[model samples]
Target: MIKIEQIFNKKDLELFSTEEKNILVNVILEKADVSKRERKLDIFLLSEDVLTEQILRKINQIISYYLPQTMSVSIHCDKLEGENKGQRLVTKAWKGLLQCLFTEIPACRIWMLNSRWELKKDCLNIYLEPSGIEFLKGHKICSIIENYFIKLGYPLKVVFQEKTEAETYDVYEEEREIIESILKENEFRNTETNINALSPNIIGRIISGNPVPIGNSIKGTGEIILSGEIFDVKKRELKNKTTMLTFGLTDYTGSVAVKIFLSGEKKSLEYRFKEGLWLKIRGKIEKNRYTQEYEVIPFDVNINEKLERMDTNPEKRVELHLHTRYSSLDALCSPTEVLKIAKKWGHKTVAFTDHGVLQAFPEIYKASKKIGIKPIYGLEAYIFDDESPVMILPPDKPIKDVTFVVVDIETTGLCFDDDEIIEIGAVKILNYEIVDRFSGFIKPKRPIPTNIINLTGITNETVKSAPPIERVLPAFMEFLDDGVFVAHNAEFDAGFIRREASRLGISFDNKILDTLALSRIVFFKLKNHRLNTLAKELNIKMGSHHRAVDDANTDAHILQELLSRINEVGISNLSQINDIYQLRKGVNNLNSYHATILVKNSTG
Candidate 1:
């Protein structure tokens, strides 16, 4: 008989391989505690039914690896079995409620609420982790959960435990303050900044153009789109009598004045261009040589057409670097809005790389999971390095932190056994700023699949001229050499890179950092730690969510910030970061070459 003792902490689980992590996730309480009195391991499980033959086998395997000399293992399972039918019904209802909540909110945000429950008399007590208590008070989230359960016939009370020292000391506070200051100085307020997004339908600006402002000089010609009511019509009594028509126009942005000149036979337009009659004029703007002011000269004029100003939505572009409301004051949109726009545009995956935080992940993951959209989690981090100028390292000099490379890969599918890497995106960071970037799409041995094409917005025509993975991998390897490898899910990217490098007879064992895991440690209060959620919470903006360079760059920013906090916790080296991240050392099980196979079979 195998006995299980003690639960595995979150930190303990970090050291396990991906396969081991998956197995541990299924086990109750995970990790058996060693009992000195019994001289055996004791495992605490949530339910007796969880101890299946497969789980037992894995458990034995783990025990053998850790405690080879042990004879008998003790398994302790505590469950609420043999309950009355009413109690069972209530339990089922409670479970259903929890699932609904998880769907609505990220599990990370409400991890505390997901804790085990106890029934005493008529009151059902729901216990939460200490990290959840603060959000509970400010948001009344507990009452929301309690009222929800109560409506379903179970009266409940919520309880919070004492916080640990780790939970109390937020190492990212200083970094966040710095980021907040940077955002205030840098991020553009969404105002009348749409010149780049101006409609293509508008008449070329050069005709109705004004002198362009360059430094203090009025240089070249520019155009204007003006709409308003005609205020006055005058025949300028000059050497050559000129017809002048002046009108006022107003849009949501502001108001503008327009002028139109009609000559000879066109002077008949003055009759119809009466006062209070609204019209739109498309024209060139020129500086009045006398008054030294800019005014429009009409190229085209329309009668009674209401030219309502439109906010341009430039060709359904995906912003891999984006910030939502979660990035504190740094961002403005919500996760729902971001997801809704993404889905509407048929984007398969969207990423969230927040400023050194993962509080936004839960909402993005939960929202996207059911909708068949993948949410890529990333971070804009800050890193700290030794200030010494010399490159030579003595024992006391400490290993100088040099470069961090954030990487993202897009593949044909998930199974690495057969899947081919189609694209690679990476960003190089030095001193907390992105100094360089790398991106390329590889032509796989097989044709690109329809689903992948849809998922990544990369079509067959896209990779036709590109080189294969073998040719591209070498360049990428050279670019990534000796730098700390960072990715949202470092295991997936690192696994793929490691296996691909192995195939090429190249060796790579760069220190790795998983933003996914780091977020869990730093933003423990967050219920969900997905990239988008973190972006929203931390006010980090995303440029293009899933695309390689954008995701990598965003994650690079996150890395810099995280390194700042990591250093604060006395972790100054890549090895220490790797220790916390527990970098996975196995190949990812992604589906291989589906598109290539399909195309070949069809052709044959």
Candidate 2:
């Protein structure tokens, strides 16, 4: 499927023509059951013609009828041109159709797979949970999905996987009242250590030690909170008289099989394991004794609560960069919850800027009006746009096209002239909130100095097997792509990267912003502008001071805070801010190295 971001951009319209747009509009009108006054329509079409640059204009034109002015229309098209197009479209359509069905169908449980649609000529592969399989077998669910595709001119050859023992079911409508009554009778005991009380890095640092990047296998206990949809659960009676249950949790990061062992009689708790439920769990992490594979043994879990409706107030200022729980492990707010909190804080306009993916858009859009807030939809995308370095959205518009990637690097020494980067970390921010992260460990030719190792906790042994800087530069630069380069002390980090890129025969020229410079201008009352100091002043969490990812994350938050302050002072446009900063250069002439000297004195 085309990325939602690509489809939303007005530039995508250039692909379609006037005639094609007219054809698409006429065809859609003839087929769709839409109200005359309906301002928004998201149409996903499978076209018979191969969509080339020549024909893309029509689709663009058709989509243009609903613009940011009147109503928002997002159209995604899959051309029925390739030999596998029919199968691919069928699979894609079913995945979405099944997700929609789960919302409407009662007593139905489905474990939506993260697997991409697998298409081979005429065959398409899909899988359903046991309840979903049974529901389909009895209710002609296949026919409903098939008919929807048929209307769009495609006959599907679906290869649904056979139901497995672990395929779970949901609480029946009859069972809900009973379970609710039982839960009401025995209220939850509040734990002293709630999620909010824990440090932001506790899961990654104290509990499990930085979350093993999803997909990499490891052994031993890893205490962490994983957020994902509960897809399946399998109950087994072990020879030792303990009941072992394994559940599948999936997120954009990946999937994991979490197993919990129950001793004594606790079968009543089984009802809590509902399919399609979104949960964040905290508990013991241990490796499977036999298999040596890792699994989380969750002791406590929190199911997300529904957001309450609130009245609107038009005078509230907009929060352009805010993240929801969907931003992997980095954020603690869900789309609805973020809006609810924003509403409680008296904000009328907020942006839903989840990293890379736009999965949060649908939920945020639905919750916006109910919560009395207007959501500006945008993404913190990672793209390489070197040729065109400057792209800013108009100040009066809802959003700017420009993106910023806040970066930080840890090196063997201070001076870029002689120092080598040991690690580089950055996060992409769109509309001001962190969306995606890039982390790479570089193996420098020189051994890391003892003082540097003591500071960064990166020993010479750490990067022994890691890729060299030259090998990592290409991908790192690619991830940097076409965004505005931002750093707390922009000159230090960006300058190092530029120096390295020059050595590697790569051109590295993207506009750079120094939060240090911006902070001195915005918060002139402060005696100093260090990342940790600014973070403390703004009340944003700083995980690890010297680490690349943590510093980058903090820098992103500081940038968000600065933007909020800047907007309040009547500076809204990125271009305008850049121009002002150009005039304000040397006002403080601060560098991170200077701040580090102060930090050393304090520590000493």
Candidate 3:
């Protein structure tokens, strides 16, 4: 597997410390998948992550350095467009043929593992490197490779030659000014990856090197080393009275079981192969003829430590939320391992907010107490807070006559304390009708961040000539007169208004309704309660999401849709908004989501 980051050593991965290269290697191999039958080394990933093209080619070059010239390689991205280009080159008939040659003939294993084949009407051309040509000299592998296919009713002369290098690799040489040259021509990249850091001597010589991800072990390949935690070990007495340990190994990507017969001194080490112990095993992924499933046949087992990510940030961010195994069906991370790492990173506090289960609390307390960190106990509780009055300053006259002003505000940032409201958009919904609309942009105290500008398309240039906050705030307050305040997340929009008013010494209080809160009970089965999600659910035509006018209009439709179904949840008047959810029944009805409440002080 090519670690493009290491070969090219891009700035993207330069943050990893000198000592953390092992962790980087582990992370890289985690994404690699190899399928020999398909002749593909698919590093298919679509994340905001970077691996330099040159580094990738060099890393790949390193992987094939020891392999035969028969393995011509090139890198191609199969993203947004999809991986429709065919990868399968050799047919099923070519399986046992390659495996037999690999195990018996050293020359074939070194040169022919990834042999390129060009099947023509007249003959089959097999490209090997010049060295591979010499390795095959005086060896009968070419005749064996070709004759095996001929016996399968395919007659064609097998021609072997040096493979043509892809044009992509040649382009890599042109970019050597900024990027360090990773590999010289016909040379290997550094083979000192962290995968084999703690390789203890096993068998005779050290059985360690690159460990292929279990997901991409290039099925039926020999010398496949899988490094990860081992578990589910079962010891049974063999017919010869020797002990055999059958256990499963998982690198988090995939899992495979290994059945190893221990002899003499090795029998005493049965307990060492149990759960929670991470081990790197060198072996072969062999398929069982009867069961038709692949399993590992171990040759050497070495003690290995799973790489724990370390936070290099001087001011580390607080891990306010985490889920343990008790979270149910979603996480395998236990409280001990999580807190151990958090404590190691010098985090003062850690919180366990598992999904609705306090079963993890007892364990969380013990772990945090032992680790000398404050533990905030909480869960992603269901939405059923009767104590939280739904409508703030309820008008007490919202049975049907009260108008609802569905308002949305785009701000400079999240917190209303310091962040300013840049724009305000509102729609008046009188008895399910969009009777009026209001939209305004206000100049902020500071320039908008580049990312926010990109996200909302709200630039300083657009708002520079617009009215300042002093003028826009008063107009918005007048437009929002007496109507029940409504927004997707009413608190966020309403809070900004309150803050702006308070700053100017204006008394601002209104009847507030959260369409977000309403959607939870009204459309309880909805996967999420986002504004766009609700609008889409109701088939509403929405404008640009971040724009004030369009989002307010869309949120207005969402509010009306929720209002139509409010009776289903027994919520009618603004006063009865609190009754939308009744404790026990409400919790039992809705699905759980991931959230957390961290108590940092004595007030909690």
Best-matching candidate per lDDT: 3
Candidate with top TM-score is 3
Poorest 10 consecutive residues of model 1 by lDDT? 590-599
| Residue 203, candidate 1: alpha-carbon lDDT | 21
* Residue-pair clashes per candidate: 83, 15, 2
Off by over 4 Å in 1: 1-400, 575-604
- How well is each residue in 1-604 modelled by candidate 1, as lDDT tens digits? 1112233434445555675555444333423588666667776554423455555555556555445555667666544345453355345455445555555555434454324455665555555566666655566656766776555334567544454333322223113333243223222321223323233222212223232222322244565555555654433211233344555444323444455544444445456656665555555556543223455555545554444333256554555676767776788777766777677676755667666567887888787776666666666654422221111121221224467788999888899799988899999876667788889999987766767876778866688899988999999989988777778988899889999999999989776667776766566566776776777677778677766767776777677777676677776654445343232222121112211011113433
> Model 3, poorest ten-residue lDDT window?
178-187
Instruction: List residue ranges in candidate 2 displaced over 4 A.
Output: 1-399, 578-604
lDDT of 2 by residue, 1-604 (tens): 2222233335554455675544443222112223348665555655654445555445546444333233545455555555665654554555456555566564443344322235566555556654556655566555655555555445566555664555433333113443343233223322233333323321112233223333443244656666666777877654444455678876546777776544443444555677776656555556543233466666555664323345466666676666667777758777888788877878766776666667888898799978888677766654432222123332333324557888999999988788899899999988866778899899988778868987988876688898999888888889889778889868788888989999999989877777877787677667788888898899999998899988999998998888777676566777567434433334343332211010113433
- Model 2 TM-score on a 0 to 1 scale: 0.32
lDDT order of candidates, best first?
3, 2, 1
Candidate 3: tens digits of C-alpha lDDT, residues 279-345: 7777656664423457776655677779665798999777777778997896899888888888889
Clashes of 1: 83
* Candidate-wise lDDT, in order: 0.58, 0.62, 0.65
Clashes of 2: 15
* TM-score for each predicted model, relative to the true structure: 0.31, 0.32, 0.42
Cα distance off (Å), candidate 1, residue 419? 0.7
In candidate 3 the C-alpha lDDT for residue 87 amounts to 16
